[model samples]
Target: MSGVTDLVDPPRTRRPAITSLEVLCGLLVLAMLFQGRLAALLDVPALRTGSTIFVAVCVQAMPFLVFGVLVSGLIAAFVPPAALRRALPGRPAAAVPVAGVAGLALPGCECASVPVARRLIQQGVLPAAAFTFLLAAPAVNPVVLVSTAVAFPAEPRMVLARFLASLLTACAMGWLWARLGRAEWLAERVLRRVECHASGGSRWAAFTESARHDLVEAGGFLVLGGLASAVFNVLVPAAWMESLGGQLLLGVLVMAVLAVVLALCSEADAFVVASMPGLPLTAKLVFLVVGPAVDIKLIALQSGAFGRRFAARFAPATFLVAVGSACAVGAALLGGA
Candidate 1:
């Protein structure tokens, strides 16, 4: 009774609370949605289109965001960080192809893979292979596979082409990174900040404690990106895309660049793929393949996690490889198309 009395009512102390950026972003998005200022800066077509796209993308992305955040939180809460280290091998050469195959099992879209990849790296997985898995999984997973099959209902070859081309690209990037890249380039936080520091009882407690907050934070950002996508799609001109014209090489380059800018998730990009009219089959293929691997949102995440310099170099190189793979696959397909 005396000890209990002593334990009760300890000295009061103030602790600074960390606020999430997502809340601020979500508020700002709502503000933008209500603001009627587009008429002064742009023409009606662009305004209507962009705004419509912005709204549609945000709505469309909600389910995905929920799924992504929930899955990410689960991985954070339940799956031991040690499990990741065990799953990934140490040798880069062996890890790369293995990771490509592992992608088939992970069923989420591109957005979810980012957090999961971060977790894998924190758990001491090889960066090259982790990166490879991040690139490959969204494109190869059952959802995308089924969607690809449905989108190209006529052509089993299209599905096969998307799968094989993407798999090859992911493997190639991993091998390149393993051989030529250095781990030192990774951001200090990425190389450090592991999630398993909490002890047994504490770890379990901390997970549930943090998971709710983490889910909200991630969901908020996903909403922001989705809204941005809607804005771009609705406001921007398809004619601008048509301007890419028949220049096959140029079209591939343009689509690769757009993939970075548009930041469309891997799961929905197939529909986007079906929509683009002027892009050659090769250019469209590049769009589908490169999108999951690296995009504007991913670049931002990578910059924060792996540093801006590493992001700049790695992202562009990945883009180049994506373009090449798409061209090779496209040429083979279009030759037959």
Candidate 2:
């Protein structure tokens, strides 16, 4: 009887593991259940300020993000990979500086550059060149330069210094990556080729799907970064900057850090740094150079697009190079004023 019962018994089924989607839904339900408590908690001055910063970052970035995805989609649909390869130099090393220079044509902020960079990679452009464009588009564009000129009307060299420094950073990083970067560092998703004509889909269909996918994937990271930036902004007192006036090295480091924490839009960061009193010109230059190249917001976006491994390596390297370039350019152009 025992043998018969054992034979009749079926294997037990395992429970399914929870997915991110399910966890997100659970969080939404929890938030809905405790909306009053959450609202009350956020009423504190610090929390309120953080919330405001988060919202402002998101609002300022969304339009540019949307524009990026749209451009990415257009590239996927219309720009043949062969044409891109033909347009650029055959060697990745040679293409790097060219891509950096091409960035001058795009007037959008960092948010707009990420998707375009990713799309360039998808379209068979080398990672080094794409990365160069990513850094340069936001920092060296005409719009950013004009804004900087307006922000520091008396110091016209500030604009030139920023352009040269940022372009130098982009090209330097590109060459570095071309020499030493490993393909395995980037996520498979970034390198994977999407079938634009899958199931005989139209180019328009491909464009819509590609844009929608990027918007959904990258947008979540953007929000996450905004939250992080907000928390950092609140924790770092504004008064701390005023006290660092005489400490050149310390001021440069702190200002560089502030650039990452603040995550200001590139078009507006010049004005923001310009308004901050007491920091030396070198420190201010570092802030301008580093902000567009390696901020908390850009880090989050890079992690989402290329994977955490890539962001971890690429972001720190970019930050260091940006600081160095800014300091050198500032000394040469501003005479370390």
Candidate 3:
């Protein structure tokens, strides 16, 4: 693969968002090559503002992207996927929380989880249990924990709140899927792709190989998402967010849209979500809960691991549950919407 292709991929396809960025970038390059009308596009204030927002999103997500890529590398190395496969809970009843707690031990992004979870399924771990851990572990890992602690410095409770909400939502969704969901909803290819590896390699080799593979894959996605989000911000108007702010449900929808649109890594989402004002605590909570389970980057990873059909069916369901949990927790914590 080309060095660029080695890095892995976004979900937003909004014309205004994606198009404006592309046009502007193309224009800038063309401007350097041709000048005149290409540079004149910036004189249109709205378009100019959009480009600025897109750039801002890209810049803001950089730290999270870097951290996620490095951590994904570590997971590919020190943490053996098989280590947890053998230890997963047997019964679906007990498996969900076990999976959620297990998240603390395994390190990776939601992207990494798809590959790892698929491995567990192949290893004969319960699908429900594996899926639960897949949803939770990325958000509850040491990296996320540290990021959460740092994001809400004004309120120590925010850290604890995020942990509790994430744990609850992950386990709850796992249990729900265990009881009512079907593994057939997942694609066969995901199983084939994620577990198709020479796992018998030495630990060091496995680590380096896995890390390099994951880093390239995840990093590639980050760059794509970064550029895309930057483009969206530049082309789209801030008024879109303002409309979302007016109604509570609308606010959550906005956050959900942002979750999908921005494609922020789960480890880094806490800070980004935490920074948005005017969004209800419940909506923000949904941002946290749904981000790890069903954002754009995650959707791509899930597609690779579970198949597009399975991911489509699974993500919306998981997202709804996470939003519910976030809303419930926000109500309890803040005493209302």
Candidate 4:
């Protein structure tokens, strides 16, 4: 019996690792337990302001986010990869501009564009074209343009400058990526496809699953971004705008950075920038162009969807392209004011 016991191995038990869901649940429970304390802590004016900004950002973006995921799901379920491929130009280079133009039809904000772009790539749309659509959709869509026009009623040319700059930025980034992008830059998960079935019932299942998965994944990043944006908004003094007056180069750079930090919705950003005094049209154009193309919110979304490696490279490139495009177009249209 001793010899048999020595030869036999003992059964091993492994503990399950805690997942995000478990951590989230724990946080929720803690928050519930400390609700009064949390509310009391938010009584400070700055904290209250931050909370309001956070809530506003989330509320403003949620509808667009949901719309995007649904559209992504629809694409996954109904749009055949082959059909999409056939619809675009055979050559990726030629398809890029077409994709940028196609963006005009999608009236949703930047939050809405990210998932749709990812879905397009998953559905066999050329990466260059898909990327173009991603950048162009939020900036060039009619709703955004109309809002811009309304925001700057005195400067009708602002609308045209924004459209051209955004469109150019999108196409430029697409062309650049087509030339230099490596498949390894993207995470393995982004390229992997969720299997979709051909039958009607199966398609509906696929749509719901895809939408739910995307919403769950992207929603976390969106909340994180909103928190960051609120913090920055609270900490950054509005008085800085007065100091930047008469400083063209510095104003442009600062406004560009502010656009990234603020992460304002494209449809509403025009009004925000328009409200800021002491900024030239060129600086304002940079802010308008850069906000929709790349911001902290969009950065978080890109990092979540396409891994940090891709976002690290893509975000900076898009920023520079967007700024340059805005400057060039502003020069032509706004005459640098």
lDDT of 1: 0.73
Ranking by TM-score: 4, 2, 1, 3
Model 4 lDDT per residue over 1-337, tens place: 9999999999889989999999999999999999999988768999988989999988898899999999999999988888888989979789999999999989999999999999888887888999999999999999999999999999999999999999999999999999999889988877876445587898998899999999998999999999999999899988878898777789889999999988889989999999988789999999999999999999999999888999999999999999999999988998886
Where model 2 places Cα greater than 4 Å from the true spot, the runs are 1-38, 195-201
For model 3, the run of ten residues with the poorest summed lDDT? 189-198
Q: Compose the digit string of candidate 1's lDDT tens values, residues 254-281.
A: 8887787787767788777777665577
- Cα TM-score per model: 0.78, 0.89, 0.69, 0.93
Ranking by lDDT: 4, 2, 1, 3
Give the whole-model CA lDDT for all candidates, comma-separated. Answer: 0.73, 0.91, 0.68, 0.92
lDDT of 2 by residue, 6-76 (tens): 78969889999998889999999999999999998778999889989999999998988998899999889
Point to the candidate with the largest TM-score: 4
What CA root-mean-square deviation does each model show from the true structure?
A: 6.5, 3.4, 10.8, 2.3
What are the runs in model 3 whose C-alpha is more than 4 Å off?
A: 1-85, 192-224, 243-246
lDDT of 1 at 19: 66
TM-score of 3: 0.69
Candidate 1: 10-residue stretch with minimal lDDT: 209-218
Q: Output the lDDT of residue 286, model 3.
A: 74
Q: Which residue pairs clash within candidate 4? A: none
Give the Å shift of residue 241 in candidate 1.
Answer: 3.4
Better of 1 and 3 by lDDT: 1
